[model samples]
Target chain A: MRVLIVDDDPELAELVSRSLAREGHAVATAADLESARAALVEAFDVVILDLGLPDGSGLELCRELRAAGASVPILLLTAQSAVGERVAGLNAGADDYVVKPFALAELRARVRALGRRRESAPSVTYRTGDLEIDLSARRARRLGLEVELTPREWVVLECLAGSRGRVVSRDRLLEEGWGESSEAASASLEVLVGRIRRKLGRDAIRTVRGQGYAID
Target chain B: MPSTEPGRPSSGGRSLVRRVGLVAALTAAGASLATLSVAMVVVDYRVTSDAEDDALERARALAAELDAEARAQQAVTQAQLEDELREFSHGDVTLAVWEASGRLAGDPALPSPAQDGCEASAGPDGAWMVCRASSASAGRWVLVGEPRSQLLAHREPLLLGGLVALIVVVLGGIFAGISVGRWSLRPLVRLQGALTAMDAAAPQPAPSLPRSGMVEIDDVAATIDDLLGRLRVELERSRHFAADAAHELRTPLTKLRTELELRAEEHDEGSHEGRQLLRSVARVEDLGELVDHLLVLASPESALRGASLVSVSALVEAVVEDLDADASRVRLELEDDGAVVGDATVLSAAISNGLGNALKYSKGPVRVGVQDTAEHVVLRIDDEGPGLGEEARARAFEPFYRAPEQRGTGGHGIGLALIAHVVAAHRGDAAFVDDGPGAHLVVRLPRHRGVRPEQT
Candidate 1:
């Protein structure tokens, strides 16, 4: 896999590149939007774009790439962990985002998830047994009855349902739900997963012991 | 007596209306009484003088008649003349006869004058106006006198009229003064109403006060508006500075954290060096969290960007479970799972901080309750700790303020402040209620009616 890292800080770029390189993937680094634009000519599996650049913003690059018909998955790296900033990044056609100072493992997992998005049209709904999840509408119904879920609960369930029939890592789910996969938040993820299982059913979400949970 | 306090009005001083009326009344009484007294004195003098002139004319006519009688009868005796004079006396007048030999022919008690003209004399018969007249033959003189009491008789009615005039003028002045006072104070009253209508606690800037067309009141209002504008600018500047500083710190902290974490991973798990590296990485993470808290404090309104309906009971339960503190000791009394509209992430963080504090401070079990009222959804966390004292309760929500007793607990005192910021941004209230033997933290948010529409 080929990865392009667009960041103004060389140290962060080096650390991320070194970590990804150890995972046996080819990584390219660009310090500014100009270099990033030049590097976009080549085919890449994933693009890790930083929000702030010396010359211009990475959002413009994300929009430019999408406007030019590039379907390659782009992930945003932002220091501003505010939900508004993340929404803005996603709205500009980025696939996912990680706040600054993110764990390398979480970043790699998000990269893997983005790379897996090849030639498959994203589904708006997922169904397993009597549990029906409408991702676009952010609603869930069991046996034709709507199951009430809070906003945070919905975020966790949406993440699980997005990767249907596959194991969703705990850190990734935490990052998506709580915006931080810290030790405290990881415990929150456990409690939240237990709630989702209870709302759906006992056999709704299968916990794969120390690994994570999956929806079949 | 009205109070001198600026805004509050107390009935401790005389009203301006009454003062004005009293002054007007005094002025009118003084002027009216002075003019009436002067007019009454002049009228009394005129009455007395006119009566004296009439008495003098009567005396002269009587003296001329006596002379005619004396001339008509040259052989008439003095006794016969006295008899004729005695017949002329009537009412309050006294008839006296004086001969040219300086002797009284009749009534010797009558006062004798040296020459003709009128004179006032006081004798055993009280005061009298007397006039002496000579006969045409100059052989005899006649004197006629009247009491002064009869001459000044009209003065009583004049005094009564002066008193009545004084009373009427004073009453009229009072009425005019009150009406004038009320008319002139209309603008001031309007200015007070406008000031009372201002909402000082609202997040939005207060609207400029309406013009009262009074210079002093309008000047005060303009000064208040200017002060508010300046305060708003100052507050905005500080918030922006805080946000910008936190943002600038993030990138360097990110590099340090990643480097420390990567370096810690390179060593064996149980090695002392590896443990030290992990601890350093944890410290860096703590710094990052501090930065995040500062950002939230700086701009809490921005946290509502992705607002949605959040269940208060569920949020409490989730936070309680998430706490690494002994979760088994927490007793959750979730009476209602009501919903509120806000950013779930920030709300969750605030709840987690609250529950975390309760568990950390209390020795016994912590009680967490979620109940919905008519308009608000309330969350209460009760801890059986040494409850916050009066001083602690006041300053607990200030940033970085730690109670002396809780200082050695090895945690930053930003939890409650962060909770306050989040609650205020959501237009909610967070308060500490003293419910005996524990610290009770109550957070109340406006209840969002119905569940959020299926999120789009």
Candidate 2:
């Protein structure tokens, strides 16, 4: 798998590349903004970016890439682990952010997570038993037959499916389904999850108790 | 201008109260004195002229009489003139005559006077005003005089009255000055009160100045408020920088520990090198925890995003579940479902610190409970630790203040302090109750559960 690592810190970049290479990824490293932008021209499955760079910020690069219609998954590396900074990165089109000096194992795990998501980028779909949900087309089918799922139910199903095995938090699901500024009740999210379960069969989604839900 | 530096507000010139009072008093007193002096000059001129005209009239009348007397007799004697003048002059008027040769015939005590008009002189009898006239046909000169004190007697009484007037005028000027000063400076007084009433001890100093209704003063206040806002931003940035730096440090430490664990896992669990690596990872974990607390403490209120609300009982239970290693030592009892409006990351950090602290210090089972009320909600963690000492109770919330007994122990002294900082930012309270057998740490949060429904 092709992976691009963007970081101004040569040592950190080299270390991450070496670690990911051990996991059998063809890792390419860029030390600054100009090099990273140049590297983005080549088709890469995932881009691991450091927020701070010598020439410019990674957030600026993420924004530019998204504006240029680059749909590759971008993961941000931030030295400041403040939630505000994380939200800013996300708003700028970064899929995820990890604090700097992070564990190679965790970084690899996140990159693998991104790779798993990227593998299904064109038509990301989820399946369990006879139930299959199409995320790109916002469709759901059971045993090759299209089943009508309400718009809200589809959103809940999509969010849970998108979380990939990780727990999709109640707040995140609410925000994604009801828009970011939505003050929708947590109970509403649960009800939507319950409705999705009823339509897609009972074992389709797993309730992770206080956190949120996950795909069965 | 980039107002990142510590700025002092420029004053709007002198104190309004002082300036107004001084100007009012000076204007009132000066106006009174000016009017009094102008009146004095006018009255003095009139009185002096009238007195001179009366003396001249008296002298001219006497001269006519003497002239007639001389014309009647054709040979009037000085003794006759003197006797006739003495009868006419009663209290202060005296008459004198010179029969063309300039010889005085009246009171000799009077100084040599003008022979054609009136003159005031300091005579031997007293101050005297005399008038002289001549009748050439009769070949006789006649003079009439009176004491000058009559015209000026009123001056002494007027001086006393002027003194009384001056006292009254000064008193009235002070009263006017004070009233004017108070009236104009009322806005400034309100501004001062607003400044003083500000909470200086807030975790984040908010120096918000109220509008004073005066243009210049309000402008000054606005400028000051702007500077204060910039200063707060600068301070918040620096504080967050420290937190960020510590967090950055933690990431590397966490990575190092993870690498150590992976390497150690590949080796024998009883191997010497594996044990050493495990010990090193434990040390890294401790450092990571310290950095996490610092990050929590350094975090400001601006980090709160959206209308994020989390369940108090659920969050406590989740934390307890995550710290599963101490499952046997900790007990959880949730009474009610309570919610709080806050940032999730910060709340978790604070709760983790408190729970970790109880587990570390307690030898017996730790009791965790949630008590939710309508107005407020509390999470109490009771540890079977060496409860708080007198000194610990007082300085528990102080940062980095470690007890001598627990100095070399696992827990950092900043845990409670970090919790306090978070609670203050959330507008809540963190307190320790030592009445129980162990340390009772209570975190009180404002219970705000807003359950907005999504339309069907």
Candidate 3:
């Protein structure tokens, strides 16, 4: 996976690049919006964006990318955690949002998830246990019965289902499914999982207590 | 009342020591002048009276001598009379005589008598007579006398000189008072100048006040210096707090903004990834708000006390209006004319924070209401959600407090803390109203006047 990181802070950009690199993704860094825009022309699997820039906002760039109908995954980075801000960013067409001072592993996981989502593979369907996801149709079914999930729940399920049998840390789930530093992530995730469990049955997923969750 | 204008240094502006010295000098001068005037008048009166008495006695003796001469029928020549009269005519006296027939006698230079006998005394330019008569040679008589004016005239020069000396002493005393006044007030003037200089040179050491040896001025200067020291300490503390808050906020903001820009750069417009990036940017924004609220809560100025006129109804309306978009599921109900006297900003912030919290936690719609109670303006915000337990409710307003159920709700726990601070600033109280189907938080602020509608 090819990931590009754009940030004004060289140290933070480098740190993010290194973290993503450690996750087996080729990472490139840009310290400002212009260079990052130029790097966007080059084929990249995902982009990790910092909202604040010396010359412009990351949000404007995120909107530009979405307006151009480019399907490359974008993960926005911000210092704020206000709901209105999150809503605005989401409304502006960002796939995910993350607050700064985030854990390295969390950033890596989010980048990996974005990469996986952005790849235009031939198969648009995903299967995990008895659950099946049709990406092209925007539908999920278990036991051939359609399961209704909120947009957020779908993202969470998608990230978890992509990992399939692997343990997905709570932090990674928060960063990938919602945004990093989401105060409501765990509770929201619990609610989502409770709903998912009602449809798919409880034993289909394994809770790892303090560590994470696994789906078999 | 004394004028505030500065007086001349030689006058009332003199130092205390000099003024005291001048007062002593004036007192002595006055005393000397009084003594001199009294002494001169008394001595003049005494000498005049004594000379008159002596002249009267000498006239009796001379009359006796003239009587004995007349009895012997001795012819008295002009020259002989003059020679005899000269013996009585010492300085301060002049003698003359008249016969019983009213004829002038004694040197034949005397003016004719208008009337015989003795007359009341006069002085200076006026003449007065003291007369004595003796029988000579069968009912013929000779009169001997002196003018009283002659005796008083001699002392005129001495009395005039004494009066002049007294006038001079009094004038001198007044001059001395002015000089003394100026000298006495010098130390006070010096202290005032030093204080002015100190104020002008703010943040710098003040020049020492002149030690005029006046205890009162010295004490005043010391007190002013101490007050300045306290002010400086307070200023330094305020500066320290501002610096600490700035440092705390900047690091996180810088990092978050940098990362947001970085992430925004790689995604293309209208892409699924771009939408995620925008959402991330929005979350970053929330952090800025959190920092702002935290700094405001931490500020000492924000903790200031004292109540002002605040309209609870209007404040609630304003806050609800701000939260309307976000609180689409909430309804606000305000009682007419819910007004209170309190810190308006603090109250508003508290109410808004409560509303925000209610909206954030509730699964269903939230409700807010303001009512004018008898003693307080009460505000209540209720949300249809899982209310806190006893333990969570107890520590809800504590700094950085988060319930186990709410830890993953994206709350920093500072919202309730901010509400608490706002309530405290208003000198009001806040508490959980209920724990039933929905969470209800109530705040009460005291009633006050001057709640203008236009101001709100």
Choose the strongest candidate by DockQ: 1
True contacts kept of each: 0.32, 0.18, 0.03
Better-scoring candidate (lDDT), 1 or 2: 1
Residue-by-residue lDDT tens digits, candidate 1, B109-228: 668778888888886777877877777664677777776776666577777877887788989888877777666666666666665665443334654667777888778878877887
**Interface RMSD of candidate number 1:** 7.0
TM-score of each candidate structure, all chains considered together: 0.66, 0.56, 0.33
Each candidate's DockQ score against the native complex?
0.23, 0.11, 0.04
**Which tens-of-lDDT digit does each residue in A98-166 have in candidate 1?**
777676777887787667554442447878776687764445666555555644676667677778789
Per-residue lDDT over A97-189 for candidate 3, one digit per residue giving the tens place of the 0 to 100 score:
665455444566667666656653222576766567675334656555444333455566666666777988888778766666476567657
Pick the lDDT winner: 1
Which candidate gets the maximum TM-score versus the true structure?
1
Candidate 3 residue lDDT tens string, B1-456: 122433323454535555566676679687977798688779877865676467557767777777788888898886787788787666645566556565444533333343434445443445555544454442433444445555567778877887787678767766776666656667776766555544321345542445666798778877777777777677658756854665456556546654664565567757888777767766765665565576557554333342333456656655664563675676767653455544444556677789889988887888888776667767889998899888988899999989888888887888899888767666678888655787899887665433222211
Q: State candidate 1's TM-score.
A: 0.66
lDDT of each prediction vs. the true structure?
Answer: 0.76, 0.70, 0.65
